[model samples]
Target: MRTTPLLVAAPLAVALALLPVMLVASGAQQVGLWSPWTAAPALATGVALAAVLLPRLDLPRLPWPSALLLLALCAGLGTWAALTHGEHLVVRRDPGAYATYALALARYGGVPLDPGLDVFGLPASDPWVRVGAAANYAVPGTGADGSATLLVSPQFLVGVPALLSGAWLVGGWSGLLVAPAVVAALALAAFAGLAAQLLGARWALLATALLGVSQPVVLVARQTFSEPFSLLYLLTAATLLVLAAASRGQRARLPALVAGLLLGAHLLVRIDAVRELVLLVPLVALLAGRRHPAAGPLAVGTLLTGVPAALATRWWDSPYVASVASSLGPLVAAGAVVTVLSAAALLLGRRVARRWDTTGVPRAAVRAAALLPAVAAATVALVGVGLASRPLWLVDSREPYLPGMEQFVGALQQQQGLPVDGLRTYAEDSVVWLVWWLGPVTVLLALVASVVLAAVGTRAVLSRQPLPRWLLPVVVGLAVTVLSLYRPAITPDHPWADRRYVTVTYPYLVLAATATLAWLVGTGRRGTRPAAAVLAAAMLLPTALATLPLATARTETGQVAAVGAVCAALEDAGPRPAVLAVGFRARVEWAPVVRARCGVPFVGIEEPSAPAGTTLGQVLGDAAATARAGGYAPVVLVGDLTSAQTVADATGVTLPPVVSLRTTEPERLLEERPLETREMTVDAWLAPLP
Candidate 1:
């Protein structure tokens, strides 16, 4: 009655592959068309299923040609992402800064200001204060004599700018758009390789496939953001650290050093990654020291790489320092400080271990030391709770873009007559929402895996046993879970996937979930494997369904598109330098985009209000006069009809239409109401001369 593993897995593989086809067919039927492109997902699902199952089932390895074809199919999808929808729609000024940074870095070797660039309504002497502030400065500084001496870069890091600079150098503006895609592709490949090393090929392929389709990957990969680089460096560091632990002799030392370098370098990619260093340094120290005396090398490597980045950040005066101080409570910040100090103490004591000729400290002591940071982090987080305490839920959760603290506290909404509930309810709903978006089945498996792995690591440490192979992953998973759990405000928006807070840990999560599912299915049992395969297939669909739009969307569907159309129109309006007057609502974002896209000098016109004793027309007239005086010819103004009418009424001049673009449609994708619009007809006209 003996049966081969391949024989047992064949029916399950076939069954799992067919499930996606059925889902796709059903989806197509509901839409009433079976287009060729629609079939691609089903085919991809089948191929991915085979890729995961065949080797695990001990089937004959596919020959080189088949392997190459499969590899090409996967790689092709990763590459196409850069071409089709790589640039996610820009909704705020921050995104535009990436282009500015790229251009600045390429030309100036830093983000130093270029006053000659058509930024801040060039040649307008009024300071265009609104425009100035958005550009991170105040125009015409109110210095005692009214000289503009002050400019600011705001609370931002230069990581993304630094990366974009290289792209600008390579292919100029267009290359900047393509840069994120390249970084994303590399990240996917690296993630797959890391997964294979830690969780085996089956898990690796599954995680890689999921990441390729994940909304976060699709959106962030093409946009000028620091997250992609952060993920790449984080994954690389973890991989190197894992290899160092698994190897011996000098082999381990090199990886340990390299691992430290990558981890330290990660700071330059994303400042937020400092949070991970708290856990990573201590974990690497313990794990690498298990079989070999590599802890010293790891510590030294981390210090050597980390110190310069820290010093540079201090010298640059991180824009985020103020924000972090304001947003993060004292206790939370203190806990983070304590965590770093603890890791440093452990590393320094590792040297002391050599002095004492000790194998290691007692197991109880080691476990207690490791637990110190987590305990402190949790206890200190309470201060934040007290500072912003409110009912967990409110009846009228009307705003889609409410602040995180408000969502958690519900105090403001409650004061305004919305019903509210206590903290217990909020905590419960947050947990459920997280599980729902992450996939109920996947979350269940991950939970089981985390608990089991954590217990094993704890027991091994406390009982003085050889370090378990699973300890590194356990530490990583715990860190991610703890970080995610602390964020009280929970939003389950599909495109943004608010639960994607722990994206850095996504690879480890997939490994944990996949390993648990594999064990549950009992690979040796022929009958149960099919059931496990079905369950595994089901978990992936929800995420794909939710994130597919995000993966495919290059630009938002509503206001952003309309605004882009206007910018494109401005671009087509010829090479003449014009002082385009934009309405207040549009100016915050439009000014930046128009300046970058249309290469036009822009004037920000205030709405429904003007400086005291100065009429709206006088302001418009002055802006136009200044631009014309500064040599900008055929001065043109672009704004909503109301703002245009305001200029016409105040100046008592006839307005001639240059062009007019439509109002942004209601209910558009990715529109943040506070910063964007769905109302207001935008018009461009020849400015009436003073």
Candidate 2:
């Protein structure tokens, strides 16, 4: 088969070209200096760099047929993503948080947002006043000297926001909304490139199609989530690694270095990407011992970006880092151990190869290795059985960390008509979660294929032969997938939790399943090839059936219009230099939107039960008094009529809602798959300070 470097290089180029843009934007934001101007120049420089350097790699062109297929897949998926794209503008979940972060970066240029609190002249020492000043994701705190208050920063890293900010600059909100579709298309192309390198072009097309059509892939592609960006980076990195491995001499070093840089860049995209970085250490050492010319460069390239990203995250996104510190600490320790062990093994292996004689090895050991494929297959089956049976015997629950998370879960359970168990994680049903989306057939096939591939990898290791370039990535992907499934540290809600699968599991399984079919087709007798093809075609049925329900059902519909209505109402309310203080229920979902879209200073009032020192009425009275004194109109905002009445009573103002609309929100499922969205009414009441 002819090499098709352009197929992979094209998508990789796009992502690599944006690397510097993300870095520069993030670095600028670190010093509160980020803006569209900063990103534009960085983007131009990155494009120019990619144009010059990528061509110098001298990658071969993709065949026209393969190119056409890739184009078709991207076009189809991109169109679907656009038509069904979500309007997750309300900061209720990760997608909303990401969108708000991008909005802040695009509009305000940086975080630690100044909500003009100094103008309000409220007592910062008042606990209730402080609670009212906080927004979801945008944690509120005082400045260095602890005198002035500011929205401390946004959660998660700057990668998604930095990238999305460029889209916002070019096309405003519309561009930001459709940016994920573009990312999805690029990610699909990258996945195809990696698949084409490992399998043949025909099989790669099948794999790409399978993955592209999967529900989880489609679900995330429609929203502003980090998974799509992470997918693009990881797939591009793997594709480049394969290209590097296939090349010889100094020619191989460039792609390997680029691959390492991409993996390092993944750190910017995801804090947990340190796992991938750690996993690369052993693979690099193994390749080095095999006399691979690219190994050293790969290591050097990773350190180039990885070191800076780590330090930057620690400094700028410290809250997010601290939030995941429990998991991150153990992961880091494990990585250190793996790095040391891998280095020792690499050294010890070289010595053994030079001194020991393979001829003295027992024949039984070889026979046991030969049976590895069977052993692997059985292990996969047993593990699946174990996980599938977990719900039957296990009742999993956990303490909620996020404020009001338990209450939120209880509400969802009440809506779903289940026994209200606020603490129930439903984590034990994680395997069943996979079955809900991938279907039993695809899951089984993927498991078998994964294990079989591992068996083949084991044999190569024992024989001291250089491992397949794709093997390292596959192994790392599998390890991470397993870990994610075991502990998906997200709100245990369907579709929301499904984003966990999008990062690696869904793509990896699609690749594995397609590869398995390809193996069957290639190894079968000439006459049996058609039968194998029929079998392969038959296998897609379960996945197609699984995806049929949500293929066109758009979630979070009408949200954009709802938010726009609120912004418009706020603007028209004759509130020059207005400050919007949202009620507790609205704070998490609308505080950021009010500030970013309405272009007004915003604050969030905590729930009535909050441990804040003052009553809700006192907080409202203070907010009103401060706003009048500062010559700014103070508007109260709430998400529902109940909350609006609560605020109205507290302020002694008859607050009639200014904005009332209903939008579709993704449904929360307990033990079943989410098939449709539920209607959610969004109400916002704006009243003058009394």
Candidate 3:
């Protein structure tokens, strides 16, 4: 019994389309149908597109049950993570720059900043949303006082936040964990689908599963980070590239546009993807079976997508410096070198093209296929030479391209100390170190596959019975990917390395691995089961690794028990005016401490700098003004004699004497007094003195 490729393609396509929405839904649902149906425009768009191109529906048939299982797995893994892993209803708004934006949100709207937070208030922390939120807030017009302003742009609300927003809607904001984890899960499933498409069914699932719960992917996605969206973007971009490569004429253009858009959107969120952008161009050209010259125009179009993001990057930290600072001199030079060599190769291909004018497509394609290793090797060697710690010619260009990068490099060097071991030691310990150290096995595997496939896939394309678009890019993209990872930017010896950087490479890496398997097993119906099985196994490892540890009872019993009791009691009590943190340390789960959960805004603090800011003085002034508005000095002033003596002299009312708040520590302070009119009855705050 054999299933047609279209049998898998059409419904898998629908599953790909429904993915984000189902992933976004939290574990709980009151009116589940309306919630998902209302938000999933992507699904509708896919349906509509498929309907419009219904004739193309003639192309492939899908195994409906397998497709259903694949879709379910996304929701399953997501729900598992949401219910079991990561923080819930916790506020950890630390005082960093990200905190500042969270504060600005607090100072202005008080809407929860991240997806994990219930749309109701701050609780869940998501870095993916945080970075974008910062960029959004950076654009100014951040809601004016009172009369309802559209400060947070819904336009930017796609990907993780949009997904998490669904979780927030269903389970409340504290449960936004449900949405992103779901996205992560579905993203893995998509990985499986792509694998099935490019590599065969088993490895497709294998790659998807590996990525879904892989230590770093799960860890970052569980937090308030952008990598989940990055994963999605990479998947979409890689897919489009694959589509464009496999299809001919106008059939490829739409997907190419999609790939370009995803690439552009990716750069906007995390500006570190210029390397991937560089590689996407030629790979797409090679994959499309178009002549190198024809591919040139598409490459330009793809790059043009980044222009909006480049403009934003310039806005972010000053453009003149970002370009150079971002490049890290040697990497830029290497990129330049690759561009020149590749261009020369393309130009030379003209002679080959002319010579083979009647010689036939296969020979021309083999010639083009021949270019893969040269470009790949050039890319790899560039990383090896340029990205190391030793200073080079790039030091001159550092002033413009990357103003802060060299300074960061200097700081890393100074901190690293005399022995080069310091450099190695630091690199090994950082997230960059972890991935690069471990990534080689996978990368090498992918690299070998990419090189072979680039040659093979190119040959096939030239023969005019080409492999799919996605497969070709996977080869070249992986070729470039392995090379890019070797650079110092990801080496941690450089300042640019981070845990999330791998998101840029994930799509191609998986695709290459998938392509390898596809080549090995063949993409015909005969290979589907084994391919699916392989993907399943790869997924379980990471998913278990990511989900199990978090599910285990790790929280201190006292904190958990106390928070649970408090939350239950609070729910029962409903909107009481009780100040949450009374005189401090009220419970083992201290109110202020619990209040400091990640992604929650600083509620009680005031900003001292910039216009319309607030301070302790301003707070008191506002209180005094409130008193004046009521036709008398209504605020009860209370404190120590230093302040009591001063207040006695200034205002007619004498402030009360102060006393030690902690009997153990003389340094600790407190004050109390009675209000004439019960002014702002905040007990922990010094009682107004008479």
Separately for all candidates shown, the number of backbone clashes (residues 3 or more apart, or on different chains) is 2, 0, 44
> All models: lDDT?
0.51, 0.76, 0.41
All candidates in order of lDDT, best leading? 2, 1, 3
* Native-referenced Cα lDDT, model 2: 0.76
After superposition, candidate 3 runs with Cα above 4 Å error: 1-62, 88-171, 265-269, 272-275, 284-352, 355-444, 450-472, 487-690
Could you give candidate 3's per-residue lDDT for residues 1-690 as a string of tens digits?
A: 344444234433543444323222211111122244555564576456545543442232236555555556556656655554443222221111222222222222222222211221222121111212212221112222332222222112223343444454456434444455655664565555556656555555556555554444544545445566566666655655555566666666555654565565555444445666666545644543344222544565556556655553343443223334545445556667777766676667666777778776675667776676466555544443444332333221113132233454455456545322222323223323333322433444455555565555545544545554555455545544444444424323311233434464655655555555555555567767696456544434433543444333211113223334443433333232121111111211122222222222112212223454433443434444543443332222222334434344443554332222311100100011101111111111122312
Q: Decide which is better by lDDT, 1 or 2.
A: 2
Residue-by-residue lDDT tens digits, candidate 2, 283-319? 8987888888989989988898888777766644477
lDDT tens per residue, model 1, 539-606:
67766775654444444224335445655555554445554454554454455445444555555556
Index of the highest-TM-score prediction = 2
Q: TM-scores of all models?
A: 0.69, 0.92, 0.55
The top-ranked prediction according to lDDT is 2
